[model samples]
Target chain A: MSSTRSGGRSAIVRARVLAAASDLVTTKGPQNVTIPEIAQRAGVAASSLYRRWGDVGALLLEMAAERLAQKFPLPDEGSIEGDLRCWTEKIVLGLNSTEEPIFFRILLAAGDVAPEKRIKALAPRREQLQAMLERGRARGERTPTVEDLVDHLLAPLYMRALVGLPVNEALAKHLVERLLNTPP
Target chain B: MSSTRSGGRSAIVRARVLAAASDLVTTKGPQNVTIPEIAQRAGVAASSLYRRWGDVGALLLEMAAERLAQKFPLPDEGSIEGDLRCWTEKIVLGLNSTEEPIFFRILLAAGDVAPEKRIKALAPRREQLQAMLERGRARGERTPTVEDLVDHLLAPLYMRALVGLPVNEALAKHLVERLLNTPP
Candidate 1:
């Protein structure tokens, strides 16, 4: 009955629900996805999901924010160029693969509850980018700001993918090259 | 019914429906707004709206696309720098306006029926950019590609606004400067 005693069980339920929600959103598309369906798939109570996340959009924001962190951990390649290049490529792949529009849709679809939640989703990635840039600076290399990365590297790929245009390693490589070569 | 008479009447219906959809989407969030509601607001039959648009997603795409064309006609300031800056500023305002999240949400939410529909939605905008760039090129103003404009100018503002970040004229001016200054 203790709150601490139930923490482990609570964590398991959270993971299962998020995984189910992610699977459904990517495979079936978010429009086709639902809370009852996610609860059924996760083997949890629909009431519990409602009580925790409140709605499908909230659940998706959490799931996507988590997936972004887990799936695209920053690459630790020695040089900043190498690090950013690897990270950007992995992101382009994720954005273009099974996750495609769903990942993008969830990120872009946040409403009034979203700015706060959306910040939670993107804040970590922003930190990761800043850390990478700092490493490059420490290595006697000048690095662009986080906003620069978002503008030149990540934003293009995401916007392209969101708009259903061609996006790939070639485009990713070009973006990184452009981002790095341009003077700060 | 002759196709010509129906064509003018059909044009009227489309204008009314899109205007109604845009108003509803901005006032009531996309999820809260529905095709039936759009039809009722437009003074059209729900069945007719369904027959024409097929679904809410399709309807939103068309409405947003038409709005894009009507609301944000490209500017002509006799120079690329002036034209692009003016145009980017206008877009930042629109994206940050009442449409805010909805303009972005609708654009980012397209799925299976989207690519062709999506291209139709964005292609005119692309051409307009190309024409602007060509004008600059004719004046020997050395311009960035349409891709550059998207990546540097449009994408960042869109991604930032889409993610609920602060986007304003200052930021839009910065993007235009970067896009124009970055060399080939």
Candidate 2:
């Protein structure tokens, strides 16, 4: 095969491996998933898997980063409350999505075990939220401090996710309302 | 041994075993801990460990319940803000406690995988908070619903614990202030 074709094949292999790993993490808890099992599921050779990702943890971290990026698109609803509602509702929906909770729990556990990796994985997502907040502030909306955002907005969402609490649209709306209405 | 002495000895053994299990969970991530290792650390026979708890999950569940009970003692300082500040400061301290994060992550992961166990472990702790809120309500404080309490108070605390974020007195006080000031 030509060099270009080989490059395309390699990309396909990586995608398949990541997809298989994500599926395994969803079905079986991250603690239960093994590299061999992932390789088998991906129909990729073990050597190829190792060459690409080094280990299951690395692969899982990458998968988590990818998943997070996909899950949180920067919301632009023109007003702070509208944007927050749109963003938070998406978060609640993502949390409530079937199989997403398991995947999220695994990623969280991974973060707990590895702080540096956690920072790296979350930096981009945090930046996205930060930029969105800055935009709202520029628009003369009462944007909360980052600390407040984490405590009032993100933390509550995460806590519900971890505790298996229902994350409905109403809950999302209430959160935004409280945050926007509460005085600093 | 006499029957009374045997009962006393069994209780001691249970305590030792649990202590050792807690230590192991703190030192080694919960996934790395084994029953035999815990038994060895506790200076008990492997059979006794298995006979008492059956498996690691059961032991961890018991440990989580025990830890939760100890960490959150209901605070009644004559006013809602005082009580919340007192209670939340303790929670922040517990979250910032070295090794506590790992233990909490394990329990949270267990909760995610098994919802029934999560309810069993958290029910008493939730009740304590509920009772505290009801007392404040009787004192004419604007007590939030149980659902709101989870969203506004507990969720932020748990999120910080799981994510290795700083759970400080300032943060706790801020949380209480926001909760009290925000209209339900």
Candidate 3:
């Protein structure tokens, strides 16, 4: 059989590859990172790396999925506003994190290229927020149609957080406050 | 001296380059488009293209700046809500246009990578909006701070336009009406 780098070693190798890929994306920008360079940094043959993942695109997509998973928190706050504030703050903080800046930059770049993936990738986050909003509705603390809330409240917070500047703690607070207080 | 293509031919070549770049960005994604490919598509030599612009970054930046200049119309409607509605509809229509999807997408991508440049490049559009809001304030139609209006009204419209799903025309109208009616 081919050398089975299974269990612990395999996990270690995967982490190394992911770390190398992340670092490259952060430093050089996503479009500029080459697979051979990633392989070299991971200390694996380029062929071996390719065998593990079909292509750099597949690898990067998986990397983005993993990064997004880390960034999203399951909303547990009792109030809709509290949950939204938590959610918004989490996303803003994630966008500003030094470690994931390149990952997010690449995600934005990829979203521009293939909007389908972005729509699909956002499903989980949307669902999570929707669930929280439903709970809030049941509790009589939120509006019945969370989608309206999404359009009015969350959208602006997202745009400012993503496009304007690096979302700092103060900006996150201001965004939360603005969203919470916007008229119906 | 080298063969210096003139006036009409120069303009044609420039248009070809821009069209090629835009097409490539839409089809293959912006990150995949190389300068060499653009030069070939434009029927101009790489050396000539290189001599004109130092690198791809400069070319992309100029393309972005030019695209913005074309899309952001002068707002002189004399009312803040009217001006905002005009701007929002125009931008959303631009975003949804099949011919220019990549324009909005690239602007979004560029914002993530080179944020400082993105911020600077976006200043003109904001300045125009701010100027209109200042007029509104002078006329007693708005608060002293234009940023509040931006956060509440304009930012959400843009977010909905860019985030994959088609923004509702009615929602856009409602947002502007809300902005016009809301108190500071």
TM-score of every candidate relative to the true structure: 0.75, 0.68, 0.63
**By DockQ thresholds, what CAPRI class is model 1?**
medium
Clashing pairs in 1: none
A101-125 per-residue lDDT for model 2 (tens digits):
5545655656434445555545666
Q: Residue-wise lDDT of candidate 1 within A1-184, one digit each (tens)?
A: 6887699889989999999998888788666678999999999999998998777887887788778767767888989889877987887777767635455667655554445556665676678778888988999987889877777787898887766677889889888888888777
- The lDDT values for all models are 0.78, 0.73, 0.64
Write one digit per residue (lDDT tens) for candidate 3, span B1-184. Answer: 2345567677787778777776677677765677898898878898877776555544555575566667655577887777777767776666566664565556555543455655565566567667777888788875435555556665666665444555656767877776666555
TM-score of chain A of 1: 0.73
User: Tens-digit lDDT track for model 3 on A53-162?
Assistant: 65675566556656665665567777766776676676666666655455445555554334454555455555766777778778977343545545655565556554
**In model 2 chain B, where is the ten-residue run with the lowest total lDDT?**
B109-118
lDDT of 1 at A142: 79
Q: Kindly indicate the candidate among 1 and 3 with the higher DockQ.
A: 1
The runs of at least 3 residues in candidate 3 whose Cα sits more than 4 Å from the true structure, single-residue gaps closed, are: A1-71, A101-121, A143-154, A161-163, B1-59, B111-114, B143-150
Task: Give the per-residue lDDT digits (tens) of candidate 1, residues B1-184.
Answer: 6999999999999999988988988888666678899999999999998898677877887777666666677888999989988988888777766645455677655554455557666666677778888999999888888877777887898877656678899988877877767776
DockQ ranking of the models: 1, 2, 3
User: TM-score for chain A of every candidate model?
Assistant: 0.73, 0.67, 0.54
Q: Write out the backbone clash pairs for model 2.
A: none
Residue ranges of candidate 1 with Cα displaced over 4 Å: A1-63, A99-102, A114-117, B1-59, B98-101
